[model samples]
Target: MFGDGEHDDGPRVHQQRSEGPGGQSAQQHQTHLDSIFMLLEENIVTFVKNELKKIQTVLTSDYPECLESQREDEEVLDGEDEEQRSSREAFLNISLHFLRSMKQEELAERLQSSKSI
Candidate 1:
């Protein structure tokens, strides 16, 4: 903690940076938390774009399956830390309505049923 209405996130953030390459700031790390959904959504869009060229009917269920096999930091989600996995699940839960609002009802439903998506 600090004065002047400022605060410190403390040593975990500091330790994360220590484990990585030099000079990576805490805000750089915060980006991973903030961009999880956006990054996942971008990956979905890429899959859809590729699938469109190969076939007509793209099954929404395929996304979550494909997504489960995807990786971060050169490691698959199966190897992900608890914090990251929990963050991802929480984000998916929060984004379900957004998924439906975007006309992705089937995708939303599939993710809702899956523990990891």
Candidate 2:
């Protein structure tokens, strides 16, 4: 009886249930999986938003000073090297993209698309 594909060393409840006629149906299993995926997506979105908020706070509060300090350091090297400057600019662009992706409208659109699937 335990030879069924769904039956194995899975969680004790699932393993036991899979051996019985009262086991969850495939539709129920798929729904449960979908809900789990939705919950994980929401958690990831929350984490990204919180981290972006922290970064935005830091940037707003200290960005100018940070830039000034970077400029001073760059002057010592006779202005920033081309490669280093480009790398910094690329990092900034990626950060901006993440921030935009977390915006309410963008998130709402993504949620809508996910729900339709």
Candidate 3:
């Protein structure tokens, strides 16, 4: 999913910052991660709000319960917001992958401490 014009340069291009003292604690770290996910969902919701206006125009007066049934005559839009969920998953995956890759032993120790909770 990297888009056009996207570049990582190199892993060393950007130094990862250690989370603050609050994130050092198990409960606080979970809370920090939750907050990040919440923000990402909020942003996705905002995007959906904008997109909905365009979808409404395309959907016109008639709406169908089933997407498959509508596909032949109308544009089938996903009623359930899946983009937000995918965005959150992508964010978490990237964060965890980076932590596990470069900081291997350190990340393992931290995750082990938090796993019980």
Q: Give me the candidate number with maximum TM-score.
A: 2
Selected candidate, larger lDDT, 1 vs 3 = 1
List the global CA lDDT of all models.
0.56, 0.54, 0.52
85: Cα error in model 3, Å: 18
Q: What TM-score, to 2 decimals, does candidate 1 have?
A: 0.34
TM-score ranking, high to low: 2, 1, 3
Q: Model 2 misses residue 106 by how many Å?
A: 25
lDDT string for model 1 (40-76, tens) is 8998778555434222112332565544334332255
Scored by Cα lDDT, where does model 1 land? 0.56
**What does the lDDT come to for candidate 2?**
0.54
Which is superior by TM-score, 1 or 2? 2
Per residue, candidate 2 scores C-alpha lDDT tens digits across 1-117 of: 866667656568744433223477667777888999999999867855754543344444345655564444446445557875565445445665665677755443443332111
Error (Å) of candidate 1 at residue 65 is: 11
Give the winner by TM-score: 2 or 3: 2
The clash tally of candidate 2 reads 0
Query: What tens-digit string does per-residue lDDT give for candidate 3 at 1-117?
Result: 568879777777246545666547556787888999999999877865644443333333244543344353233333335875475345445545666788665653453343111
Looking at model 2, residue 18 earns an lDDT score of 35
